[model samples]
Target chain A: MDGTRDIEALIEMMARLPGLGPRSARRAVLQMIRKRGQLLAPLAEQMSKVAATARECLRCGNVCTSDLCEICLSDKRATGEICVVQDVGDLWAMERGGAFAGRYHVLGGTLSALDDIGPEDLRIPQLVTRVREEGVSEVILALNATVDGQTTAHYIADQLEGQVRLTSLAQGVPIGGELDYLDDGTISAALRARKSI
Target chain B: MDGTRDIEALIEMMARLPGLGPRSARRAVLQMIRKRGQLLAPLAEQMSKVAATARECLRCGNVCTSDLCEICLSDKRATGEICVVQDVGDLWAMERGGAFAGRYHVLGGTLSALDDIGPEDLRIPQLVTRVREEGVSEVILALNATVDGQTTAHYIADQLEGQVRLTSLAQGVPIGGELDYLDDGTISAALRARKSI
Candidate 1:
């Protein structure tokens, strides 16, 4: 109502953001308005700039402003190790930790037969090509601990079985989390992935 | 740490987002890269368009693209009711619900002695002027439930005590929430605001 149409439009757009809804979107918009100069303006400017320049690395399937992504072009990054992940969110998680000096291979999505998903739908073929072309020696599957995620990981591992070394993230207690509160799947995974201490 | 300086810069900027840290920022970047045409391009276009046009509503503190926000120019929205909030987020939240049929007044921030914020620092003066100039009969305080928020609300109430009818959101359980899981403050507020059966 009133002259809130623009604000409303903003809220609608923000609602589409991950982990936000109409309520949170509205709150975020209001905060942006209140801090027009400090927070909102800078954010808007940066967002626009990135929007204009953003493009994918044609070879590595990584985000970049140019034809080649940072990972693909970086000569220092370990060429023999390729960390595979289910989604971009997972890739980002890896980057935040500042670990894994190797380059990444993002499998856009996991194999979901129920949803009619296949290897072609994901970047499975591209991943295989990258392995051979880049002379990868190790392939680390960092998929989520979900059913579909594990299934996809197994499928990838089977495909690359004789070609390279396959490994996964260590399962057990999360660094800042408790074990008693762990779900059935986590508990089972932890038990199965028990390492030699 | 890679060749895509622009992408790195974008990721760094994105990491500063409210809920997104470095990790989430990375995943988001990767996703945008993989879905270059469907999700990334359109999002980038919209971001640029909004960045070019976005501005604060001179009258009501809402965000808009024009000199006069759509709400302030609409003749049908002169409902004499003004919803006053501590931030633009609250205003946007209200707009998202698409319920309230009145205008909004954004008070940049709440009065906070700890942070050295005072009435002059906020838009209290503008609010007073708007009340008198806009023929407003009622003012709704939609500030947060925090100590600073309440303090600011009381201050506003005292300022316009004799001039206009003032009300606030009813305190109670939120929709689709378990009362037992609510904090003590919420429970107390709900108890104190109990209505006659």
Candidate 2:
């Protein structure tokens, strides 16, 4: 325990991460110490580098090490369509899917009246400007299915009404999802939007 | 994802930790980026410090930032009872219980015939020298109940049989353990060592 204060502090910090607890943090720190050259030193350097450079993309609020994100900088992604999502995590998820070929607009968070979050708090004003100035034809609301997400989508749709086509991701049972395991809401949504083969 | 190469590498390194996977690592990195000033920078600094300073205690093999650990330096811990554990983690676990007032000897690992590990591979030679030179009266074999742990404990006992008193931790059903949920081996051990109420 003596002279282990720094290691203990490191464990405490690791425990504050999203999924780790005290036991796991202690294990991780011990392992890092064991693999100091291969893991601990490199990790510290990488973290410091990221901490110094990581910033939000000025155009879409996505995390990047520069003024603009890769998607926002790519001319190929300027396909007259802008996908609006609640957070940078959602943007990353959409990118992982690789179906969308257009640029994105990260709102940072949904408009929550209870939390006093409005369009101004998110990047809604920037998104509206992008849609108008960039000659966007379609504005897709890829926000979550939560109530606040829907409210934010409606607000965005109202802002761009008649000027551009407004749409949202289809609500349905996911691919390979068992009907028995799905909620009633998903089943109903899937049934209502059923298509003939 | 272009500017996220450093961040992605950080996540990959984090995923190598014992209890974390890629998804959890990604989530942790995102949170750290969000709380960059409060968590990321401080954690990086602490890890670098630990990496630069942490070393094995010369006396007991416990991790510390000095040649001797706190317990080795403390005169009060010279109680003539040395608790021999398989690893520093186990020693920390005993310290957490706050029952033991004596010193500790971390063996680093159990002797394994299959892995070709012998007394020399662990700190057995050092432990023997410590017992002979430190005027120790009692040595508690606090190794695990595994086959290799028992083998190592027996080997140490044979080495110090005539020199000092030898003992081991009691085996039984854990506190608050129910008979129905307990394993047969543990139940039998508890019954064999049953104490009168």
Candidate 3:
């Protein structure tokens, strides 16, 4: 083997990450080597620690070190409103807004016809169980604007209709979105959903 | 600690890498946790192994597990020609082209007047010593097309004037680069360096 085999292997593994390609992986590996004490050691340690303990929260499908997520255990979050999202990343995005004080249900992914993924493939059944078991009053579907995402939201909406107050995020112009840059569908939706100021 | 604290820490660390930001890092961490046995465990194990053994080559400053890098140790590489680059990443790029059979000398960084970086800050002195001692005949400066990079290359050339045959990469229009989008300076340079191809 080459003398740099191990280092090359490390770089290859890092390149397989979602956002990093070979070029950035090489830079990252070099940077890690440069700051071994401050970044590499701690990162390596944390990765191992997290790899050992991290798992899907049994209650909400959020990543956690235990069976139940922090939001599920914390009584402070509003139990009446459950924001359902397609992925944990979406759940985190909502948390970053700092305005959503309610708990979440991560669906892992949306329904994909091409991939043959359906309700059973995601955490839809678990979400329905949570809605009934937790006395949830509002089931807000915060899925993406994608076709598959809308289909999944509609399916979930149908599941919980008449049982509780069901709602989905409004389809309209986003905050600070420019009208000139918006697509025809978005512009039409925004016009249709126009509100009095 | 919260149940998701460890997972969050892992995401934070992943985000600090070159390509990944907060959102992508969260997604990458979640994927890693999901594929722990297949990807995460192997990656962590490989990183730890490399972190323990990785070091810079004494001769060329290339990352390696031994005193000399693989390129330095290889008998097939030309000893008379040394491709000088500002960073190890640049050296790797040249290698990816599969044309350069010469050894390399990594300067680590360029001479930056604003950053107070001078020849002494880089591996310039060691390079001079290597040229004198290693029976080198050519030094090809493959520095970036940046102000600091040009200044560093000029400084190194001045230091080794008449001692060796110094050359640099051609600066002109990139292959497949649209002429319409080309900057004025680049267009002028390409005109000036017009070839018979």
True contacts kept of each: 0.22, 0.77, 0.61
How high is each candidate's TM-score?
0.75, 0.92, 0.93
Compared with the true structure, the alpha-carbon lDDT of candidate 3 equals 0.87
1 against 2, candidate with superior DockQ: 2
DockQ of 3: 0.65
**DockQ-best of 1 and 3:** 3
lDDT of each: 0.75, 0.91, 0.87
State the fnat of candidate 1 relative to the true structure: 0.22
DockQ of each: 0.28, 0.70, 0.65
Query: Per-residue lDDT of A2-71 in model 1, one digit per residue for the tens?
Result: 2345455666765665555676566655555545566556655655555567765677666667888677
Off by over 4 Å in 3: A1-3, B173-181, B194-197
Write model 1 residue lDDT over B35-85, tens digit each, in one string: 556555555545444545667778887667777667677787789988988
Off by more than 4 A, model 2: B113-116
Best by lDDT: 2
Say which candidate scores most in TM-score: 3
Cα-based RMSD of the predictions, in order?
Answer: 4.4, 2.3, 2.1
**Residue pairs clashing, model 2:** none
lDDT string, candidate 3, B1-197, tens digits: 45477777878888887778887888788788888888788888777777787788899998888889889989889559999999888888999998788899999999987888888879899999999998999999999988888989999999999999999998899989999999999999999999997
Candidate 3: residue A107 lDDT (0-100): 93
Candidate 3 local Cα displacement, residue A67, angstroms:
1.1
What's the fnat for candidate 3, on a 0 to 1 scale? Answer: 0.61
